[model samples]
Target: MTQTHPTFAEKLIAWQKQHGRHNLAWQVSDPYQIWLSEIMLQQTQVVTVSEYFPRFIEKFPTVQDLANAEQDEVLALWQGLGYYSRARNLHFAAQQICHDFGGVFPENRESLQQLKGVGRSTAAAIAAFAFGKRETILDGNVKRILCRIFALDGEGKAFENQLWDFAEILLPENSSEMSAYTQGLMDLGATVCQRKPNCAICPMADICQAKQQDRIAELPRKKSVKVQEMTLYWLILRDKNRIFLQKRPQKGIWAGLYCVPCFENGADFHNYLRDKQMDFDDLHECATISHRLTHRVLEIIPYECDCKNAAFSANFNENDGIWVDLTDLPQYGLPKPLQQYLA
Candidate 1:
């Protein structure tokens, strides 16, 4: 008799049972925690999410608790986590669940996808892990895994559609195995099938088409990303123990966060000061800082000034800026670099 081997899903499920991450904080069968973890994991590392997840759950243990909380509180708790939009969406989705889903998480992928920030892969993961539904997840890690396993070479919607189809086809026949199989794909990609994959230790090494074809490095094609650079000038006005901060606009980078007044350049800052007829001859240029975002690098230049005895209360009121006590600065949501600078 010819030797028989387990199918891809069987091998993955077996590997996951023995070696996958089971002690993760969000591994429980709670949809709320699973959903929150999935959203946080997008474009972020597992280690980072692990740190944030516990604090978030501690603050809002239930979806209703999250829904009732203020946006500022949510954003403040989500501080230091880049991509503030995810925090916003998670809050919004909680409200949606309470109002639309009757405070219960949707049981299936399609209904779950209706939640803001919950995409197809996220919905599938939530459904599988929380409800033991037969679903497939094709997140970045799973996409890379699929691309390498099948020796796929393409990019754009067509390539993504192919991956999605493959993802659906690769689902284990038994619904009970969905959770382990899904986690297996994530664990395999994150640990073994990385950019520089460790093929020797990979359970799917024998079956991976890329390994057989000697194209593991070339299987998953990625587009080149150019990181743009920008310069921002911040005015740090301090009066005694209080520092001035303005709420950033609701759109663009660092949206809905509190920061010192920012300008595009020195000329802009000078023009703004002139327009407001505010002059402080004691303005001192502070050290410049560079903050790197996913697609852009910001060079921040800060100008500090002591505004003691200068009554700019009326001016600040008109500009929606507030003087916050240094001791109470932790109450507000601030950009990571600004938080570091202030610290």
Candidate 2:
């Protein structure tokens, strides 16, 4: 009888057992921790999430605790995470788990998808990692790995179904090994099969179709992004020890977040100040900063206008915003770009 060679899952599992990340802060079997890590890891790197995860868990130790916490507190904790909506959705999902599932995360993929921010891939990850469920996860990293290994064709969402099929085929048979197999794909992609993949050290190097064909960089193609540029005028109004910030409408960019009062251009800003009869002791242009989002780039120009009196004029209403203590600015859930500017 002829001896059979190891399958892709077996090779990946072997590689993971030897080289995968096993000691991360959220490498536990707890569903809550797994869910948190999955959400945090979305559009974020492990190194960045590692810093915020421990602090967030310390505050909300349990799903019940997270459900009971305020949105401001949640956003404050997730201040620098970039995607503020993730924090909001996580809070909403925690409430849902508490009220709908009795504070226990659903062990099945179907029920997990009902939660806010929990997509098909994330639900699969939580189910597999926390409950040892035999579900396939096709996140960005795993997608890259599978695409390169099989040399998948098409671009963007066009190849999603094919990728999912590959994911299912690569899933380990034993449910007990689900966690290892799932994490293996993640680790292999993140550490070895990255954009500039170190194909030499990759466990799948021997079999990767992209590597074999020298098309690793071109296998997992993406949709072209056209970044739109917009200019913004920020009035950095300060009085004594407080800085005036406006609460953005709860719908657009930086929704429900605090920011400096913004205008489209310098003319609009000056007009608004003139109409409000607002005067400053010293007003001058500060350094300009450029912030790039997924599809939009903002050219932010700030005008530092110092006010002698800490009190706002009678024309300023409650809807405008509040004057926060300069010392306590970091505690607010400001946008990452704004936070960096302030810092």
Task: Give the candidate number with the greatest lDDT.
Answer: 1
Model 1 has an lDDT value of 0.88
Candidate 2 similarity to native, TM-score: 0.93
lDDT of 2: 0.85
Give the TM-score of each candidate: 0.94, 0.93
Pairs with steric clashes in candidate 1: none
The C-alpha lDDT values of all candidates are 0.88, 0.85
Any residue pairs clashing in model 2, and if so which? none
How displaced is residue 212 in candidate 1, in Å? 2.1
Model 1, runs deviating above 4 Å: 1-6, 265-267, 310-314
Best candidate according to TM-score: 1
* Residue lDDT tens for model 2, 231-341: 998888777787888887777788878898988777888788888676543578888899988889999988887766535443455767888998998677998888888
lDDT string for model 1 (139-255, tens) is 778888887887778899987887777677778889889889989989998999998999989999889888999888787888799999999998888888988899888789888
Candidate 2 Cα outliers beyond 4 Å, as residue runs: 1-6, 156-158, 265-271, 279-282, 310-317
